[model samples]
Target: KKLSRFGVRSKDYYLYLFFKRAHKSFTLLFGCLLPLFFNAICSVITFGLLFLEKQFRLLDILFQIIIGQ
Candidate 1:
């Protein structure tokens, strides 16, 4: 009876269907990859800063503000 009141789905109807079908696989993949991606970024930044000089220039400051650094 209530189904007849709203005779339309939504734009995200397919998304809801996908979640119903493949929720486990998607969550498992994300769980496995998230930590690896974060660690890779952290290691890269640490490695560069470890070997680089510690001097800061006016240009560096300016570029940092401009580029949201």
Candidate 2:
């Protein structure tokens, strides 16, 4: 496990460990991938939220609508 260097009780290990404990069918050979996946997912979600805020701002000007005022 590439993530063997990481603390087993931390976020990545706990998530995978729970999966194993529950006898889940799927497993990632490299537990380190969980942190990478979590970060990537968070980034995408944050970007989407930021983009929506900007889009609403543009809509506000176009439609003469005020938001969060």
Candidate 3:
């Protein structure tokens, strides 16, 4: 009832309702997906480092492995 004071008509009121529903779902979806996004980025970086490490000399790789132990 108070919505009419701002000139919001009955027909366009559904648009506002739709946005209210969409905003809640969007927030929930973003919260759920954020961790997966971070994990994917970390995995990509780890794989890249491994690939670069493979390009080094075999002796260097062995040295690194020995030092890591």
Candidate 4:
């Protein structure tokens, strides 16, 4: 096969297998953590916004701006 032409012999085949298994687990871990990471980031942003709104009355300012009051 083309692999043989590239000097990838049977002796080194186990390294390829090891890498394949490692890649699979890495992919699975990333897939599982990616959503959790995104959710945590979103929650932090939401809580920060809520804190700012409470402290600064951001919504009241926006309402006043909208009503020209």
Candidate 5:
């Protein structure tokens, strides 16, 4: 097996580089956006529940607060 100057085999070095790139992209995509995505999902669910549940009147109160009525 041919080894690179770093003493690691060429295939191993390529795999290491590939993993590093994948990890960086994964961190950027999931780490930064995962929480925001979850928060948005929760907000949508809560809003839908409030709007659909007339007994709560939370959505009605929110509309009143926004329209100042």
Candidate 6:
């Protein structure tokens, strides 16, 4: 019924269907990756705050060494 309604299903149609199924299956995995990306960004901000004043000599030295600053 669906095939007739949509016309004859071809290889291209099956490929699209498979991709849609795979995307739905990995929804949870995508959700987890989003938090991981934000956590990395937040860590950068927190580090910036702690060292923003150039008060931590050790951290300043490390940053300069790492960043060639």
Off by more than 4 A, model 5:
1-8, 55-69
Highest-lDDT candidate: 4
Encode model 1's per-residue lDDT on 1-69: one tens digit a residue: 556544445436767787866888788888899999999999998977765534346667778999997
How well is each residue in 1-69 modelled by candidate 2, as lDDT tens digits?
Answer: 656656655877789788787664334434667889899999999999999999988988877754444
Better of 1 and 4 by lDDT: 4
Residue range 1-69, candidate 4, lDDT tens digits: 787755666656778888999999999999999999999999999999889879778778888999999
RMSD of 6: 9.0
RMSD of each: 12.4, 14.9, 6.5, 6.3, 8.3, 9.0
lDDT of 5 by residue, 8-63 (tens): 66668799999999999999999889999999999999999877897558877988
Report lDDT per candidate.
0.74, 0.77, 0.84, 0.89, 0.86, 0.84
**In model 1, how many backbone clashes occur?**
0
Tens digit per residue, CA lDDT, model 3, 1-69 = 686755666556788889988998999999899989999999999999888877666768788899995
Provide the global lDDT of candidate 1 against the true structure: 0.74
Distance (Å) between predicted and true CA of 8, model 3? 5.0
Model 4's lDDT to the true fold?
0.89
Give the TM-scores of the predictions, in the order they appear: 0.45, 0.50, 0.55, 0.67, 0.55, 0.48
Task: Sort all candidates by lDDT, best to worst.
Answer: 4, 5, 3, 6, 2, 1
Compute the lDDT of residue 65 as modeled in candidate 4: 98
Residue 10 in model 5: lDDT: 67
**Model 6, residue 29: displacement in angstroms?**
3.7
Clashing pairs in 2: none
